[model samples]
Target: MKRIFFTLIVSVSLLFLTSSAESIDNLYLIGVVKKISHNKVTVNVKSNVCRGKKDFNISPHIKIKLEEGDFIRFQINSSTCKEKNLKILKIMKIHKPRMEK
Candidate 1:
């Protein structure tokens, strides 16, 4: 029947739209390093949507050595990155801007 065919087409379109939307947004977080251990690092979140301190797992391949006072920003859910809530995409030390004359 034409009604059954039309319903099938609409369902398929909705499925495709939902999947595409989910893949478009990637999550990221920026925070200040509060503590650093051998296998994990704790960060005080500085984003508008998220707050408080969270601990993230340290990946073996991560090149940056974190100190307690370092401020950092990193991305999550990357292909090569693992861990549930902690993946370091990029990191750097906190800096103060100097005045230019």
Candidate 2:
């Protein structure tokens, strides 16, 4: 009886762990540039944070060249307020490097 109970407990724990891991979204996220303003930004992402509202604010710590259609890499802080959204860590612009003559 003890052996069976131990097995059942381990199985339940493993199931819990797997479900939690699967539901967790990545901390690092990518989004498309939607709008930009001095010290303010908005991006469109597919994260659950969207919850049907895709636009989110980029934190003041965000470092990126403000431009429409650029992709941004950022991290989300669970403890941060909703108005600030997340921090943009990098920018990926779909452009060729300027030619140097």
Candidate 3:
């Protein structure tokens, strides 16, 4: 009986750990660029959990040029929501389809 209880506890703990890791990997957002500076960009976030204009720090290694009013999708670290450290892990611009007359 003791052995069975120990096994169950271990299984539950492993499950929690995996789920938390998956949640962190899924932290990303889609937004529109409001402004761009040397090491940061202001984005008008469109996600359900994070909506509004917020500034996100860009890594110095990422050299992508972005313009104002451009739509973008970016992945962020888990600390983004918690401590407001809004660092970008990956970033890409999204093009909108042109409307036909």
Candidate 4:
């Protein structure tokens, strides 16, 4: 009985550790706004791992005006290493630094 209980506990602990390791991490991407509609925005993502156009649903609570061809940085809730299954959590516009004469 003692051996059986110990084995069960060890198995459960290993299972928990593996699941946590498999969990996704938040992803940050820099992109150019391609289009903005009612509740979704399309962006041309420029990144080493994930590139090309991707559409993300906008959070209803977030109210920010975006235009086509605007450079922006956005955060996704979580993504796979390949950046699949993306959901936008935050968005910010990237402004170029003014050149000093």
> Which number leads on TM-score?
3
In model 2, the clashing pairs are: none
Error of 4 at 10 (Å): 11
Worst ten-residue run, lDDT, model 2? 89-98
Mind giving the per-residue lDDT tens digits that candidate 2 earns over 1-101? 99999999999999999998777343555566677776556666645654222444455664545677665555654423254445444344333234569
Best by the lDDT measure: 3
Across 10-76, the per-residue lDDT of candidate 4 in tens digits comes to: 9999999999999877778898888888888898889765688888887777777777777888888
TM-score of each: 0.55, 0.43, 0.65, 0.64
Q: Go through the candidates in order and give each one's C-alpha lDDT.
A: 0.67, 0.57, 0.80, 0.78
What are the RMSDs of all candidates, in order?
A: 6.7, 7.2, 5.0, 4.4
TM-score-wise, the better of 2 and 4 is: 4
What local lDDT does model 4 show for residue 41?
A: 84
| lDDT, candidate 3, 16-101, per-residue tens | 99998777453689998888988889989898777888888987777777788878898887634555767887886566535579
TM-score (C-alpha, index-matched) for candidate 3: 0.65
* lDDT score at residue 42, model 4, on the 0-100 scale: 90
lDDT of 1: 0.67
